[model samples]
Target chain A: MDIKSLKNYLYWLYCQFELITCSYLMEPWEKLLFYTFNITMLVMVLYTAYIFVPVHISTAFQFFLHLLGNQHENTVSVVK
Target chain B: MANPSAVCNGHLHHHHQKQNNLLKSGIYKKNGITKGMKKNGVSNGTLHKKTITEHFEQAPMYVAVLTFLGFGVGTIFGYLRDFMRAWGLEKRNVAAEREQQKDFVPLYQDFENFYTRNLYMRIRDNWNRPICSVPGPQFDLMERVTDDYNWTFRFTGRTIKNVINMGSYNYLGFAETDVNALKTVTIELQKYGTGICSTRQEMGSLDKHVELEKLVAKFLGVEDAMVFGMGFATNSMNIPALVGKGCLILSDELNHTSLVLGARLSGATIRIFKHNNMQSLEKLLRDAIIYGQPRSRRAWRKILILVEGIYSMEGSIVRLPEIVFLKKKYKAYLYLDEAHSIGAVGATGRGVVEYFGMSPDDVDVLMGTFTKSFGAAGGYIAGKKDLVDFLRTHSHSAVYATSMCPPVAEQIIRAMKCLMGLDGTTQGLQRVRQLGKNTRYFRRRLHEMGFIIYGNDDSPVVPLLLYMPGKIGAFARRMLEKNIGVVVVGFPATPITESRARFCVSAAHTREMLDTVLNALDELGDFLHLKYSRYSKSSHPELYEETRLELED
Candidate 1:
């Protein structure tokens, strides 16, 4: 056989192994849909985390600053 | 339950019809009638055919999910702990070894053994329990205590005594062969001392070795036989001597690692068939013949099928009848390893061939070990005289390793003599029959207890499923506490969810001893909640029946 045909044959042979009978290996359309759902879920998680984490971290930092820095300033200036 | 053979027969009927279609398609030339075609083209009549029943209980769907999830969560946590250790947030008391070895290129690669440090270490006490006595009906395990999380253990110098041995592979109770073969030991030891101090290929070939080989060949009903000092080496070394570059080896997926190594060393094109699945084997054989050797597209010099008579871990017998049929039809060589089944099964302790009433000539290569059943050390390769002659000159074990010791050979000779009734006693016959009785009774009782069991009822190697990895150690330690020793097998030797406690029922075990083990499992089953099989009707019929119906609902 030609190199291209042999490569195609080998790839077909590789796909014969049912890698994920538990949840995966399905009809092409169903597999495509399932993979779309998975990729979407991953993207949504990444987007939500990207939108939430830094703001939350900064807010928490502000709160901690009020607890430590404000108390030190009030004690030196107002209490004295 | 009414007729167990019906289940297996139904399976065979389905396969027969499916393959009949394939046969009609003209892929097969001769001997294609797989079900009942016997030697010399004799068609199987009703009296000539027998159905061998084998049952393997599948875990419930939820159990599989849980096992998969458990493995995943365990892996995540393990990697997280590794990250923490890397960040110096966690400290291990067992860093002593790594710290000392940090000098040169880190000779011992313990870091790569992630499973050991994380999962295996947690349950390390269940394995390698030092036994202080002969592994007969009962033995003593030296007690050990681990303070630093099984990293280092200090033996307490005290032994747990009189524990019922449910884990040893003394199938014919020939483990006491030393005691039984005492009469012959004097002459055996006197003539050829204890050790050979030489390899068999050169100076180590003693008179006893020659006699043992001849006797082995006679016993197996083969042309010739060669014995090896090590059982593992028998496969790992001899296989390469048989097949090489231009050859093809179709090995069972569950074949012993020795066979795998040997197949790799032989430089043959190796293909794996699904374990004991004839359809998968047929597909592979067809594909192999069609494809020929890869790249070159040249016909393989030879095609060999490697299978085990009884898989040690799985406790299942190979479907030998069908394999032989397939081998004959496809013109491939058959290699049968009867290491666990040789003296453990069959009517007269011949092996799976005798168990199935098939002739030994059907197999091209017959290999077996004396370690399990003969109460001796070493293994043998029995086949055509040509194979033996070739192996004698080429096999690395025969050429390099020390020969089988004199006393061990004597022990084996005595065991075989007794088994063949040449010793003028029915003791061997009795042991073989007793083993079957014990195996069946034990399996049935365990089945009735509603526990999930694996393998055929006739197999002496009984593996009771404990899905949760935690239960592997729990069942083992609890059984040890109850004075019954059992072996626990778990990941990564087996799949994560398929962890099981294996019990090897010996002919040495009396009815009462078996009863004691049953009682222990009965109590432990409830305590561990391991009785997950709703298929079986338990002793308490009404109670289990109600539960079964409720679950079905």
Candidate 2:
């Protein structure tokens, strides 16, 4: 193939790889596993938040983080 | 370094090795591959070996995904199970709280039922009939015939106007009208509001209240006075606040309910004397003086001798001179309740003490109520300034409750002013003497008519005895038909056997009204088949002769 055609072919292959990876990540099984890991990590983070930080500072930080994390997770799940 | 075909050939060799191993093993026997194996020449087939990673990659992707999915589902279920257990514990705690609340319901219900069903029922059933139920149809027939003449109907709008109001302690016509005094009350009401919202200790104390106290003290011949919301509170607060665990109260058996309630609350040992019996009072005083000795070095203090100035039910005046002598001899403090005698008895409406010409200081404490003479409400206790000061500070009823209404205090002040010569001393004293004369005339006339009169000869309260309970309602109805108003007294308030009709003679009544009332009573006696002949001196001889002949036979 000519040099331009070869460059076009390489770009097409990159797009195909992206599509395959996205479809696999968006599957119901993959989503369920992701959510379970996310919730477990959140529980551990909350427990650590109470122990390592002063109550007032931790409470304010926890509320902001929980709101941001919940919004991101909901939007991602809905789009999928 | 390797060719494509060589690498493909190496992968095929490995796959063939794995197939050979499967065929050589138990797969051939389990599958029963005798015909298929012979056709394919299974013995000559090569087998291939695969690596662990390569074998895992060959497995379905769903199997690996399902394993992680199962672990996630199991974790969520475990959390849900723990949450359900906590919810169950909370529900049990709520149920236990509800059970604890259920225990108090029956006790509250029982108290409500007792007042509603039992006490109120008895009051409703005996509304108009004398407190004592009359036997037979005689009372009913009299009531039916005398509907128009029923004075109780006119007064209370009740048909059963049978009760002889002997139970009422209103001995004087004070509860009745003194026209000039009432007119003054209307004038005072225009100036003062109806009630005082704050307690006596607060800003509610009015000038009229202070004036009433002064008037009451002067009327009773004392140095100072303090008012109470009720006669009951007057006795309950004054008695207990003065006497302590160290003191003894010598009370009369026939003392009013307020006195009894006060003595009980005083925390003092109570020594009761026989009704109107001076000997018994002396005996109690001696016993208390001896028994009240402290085991320690403390000497016994003086005792309090409590008595009513007038016995309400018996209508007997207290033997004031004798009581005063006993009180002085024993060195005991005397407390007298002149509830019935204030506006009705004595030479100048000064009650039992004035009747005997005794000084107010002779009695340590003098308590009286305005409900009787002033024709209003409230009570007062008169004593030395120190005792009044102590009571004003220490009495719980005074400290806690709303003060007496300003208008009621104003009315009492005006009434006392009228009694104490706002008009003139001559007119006031004249009215007082007229009341005494009327009481005597009414009592003598009733006694002469063969009516068994209860109470002392000087008392304005004339109780006509009807020995038979069955005749009580009939007698009251017949008297009402004659345009005469009288009250019937019966059981619970008095002994059923002593049922009678009580007539309260007022100073407002004229001689003509008295004469008319007597004539009507004579007619009532005839209508009821009651005998007036027994009262006649001329008919007595015949009655005696008839008894003598029966004895001879």
Among these predicted structures, which one has the highest DockQ? Answer: 1
| Candidate 1 local lDDT, B1-553, one digit each (tens) | 1121122231223223223433252433343444434433333543334566676878789777766665554455567657877778877644434665667675434633776666667678889989999888889889999876576789999999999999988999877626546779767888878897999978999888999998887667667899998999999999999999999999999899888998999999899999899999999998888998989998889999999999888889999878988998899999999999999987778888777766566789999999999988899999878888999999999999999999889989988888776776677777887898789878878888889888877899999998875566667888989999999998766776798899999999998899899999998887666788878464434443453364354
Model 1 is docked with a DockQ of: 0.02
Candidate 2 error regions (>4 Å): A1-80, B1-183, B293-302, B523-553
lDDT of each: 0.79, 0.59
The CAPRI class of candidate 1 is: incorrect
Model 1 residue pairs with clashes: none
Local error of candidate 1 at residue B432 (angstroms): 0.1
Estimate, for each residue in A10-73, the C-alpha lDDT of model 2 and write its tens digit: 7655433322222111225534665577679999999898877797787888789877775566
Work out how many backbone clashes candidate 2 has. 17
Model 2 lDDT tens row, B1-553: 1221132231222222223333353543454433443344532232211111100011234423433343344334334433554477322211122446775654433433332232222222223434223221112212332232221233233354332232234433344344664675666677776777777787767887787777676666556788876777888777888787877788888788889989999888787998778899988777666666546534456588889877666667777667777888878899999887776766667677666544566688888887775656778888777778887888765787677777678667765655555543444455566667767777666656666566677766666654333244456545655545456665445553455566666565666666777787776654443332234544323343453364355
* Cα error, candidate 2, residue B483 (Å): 3.1
TM-score of chain B of 2: 0.65
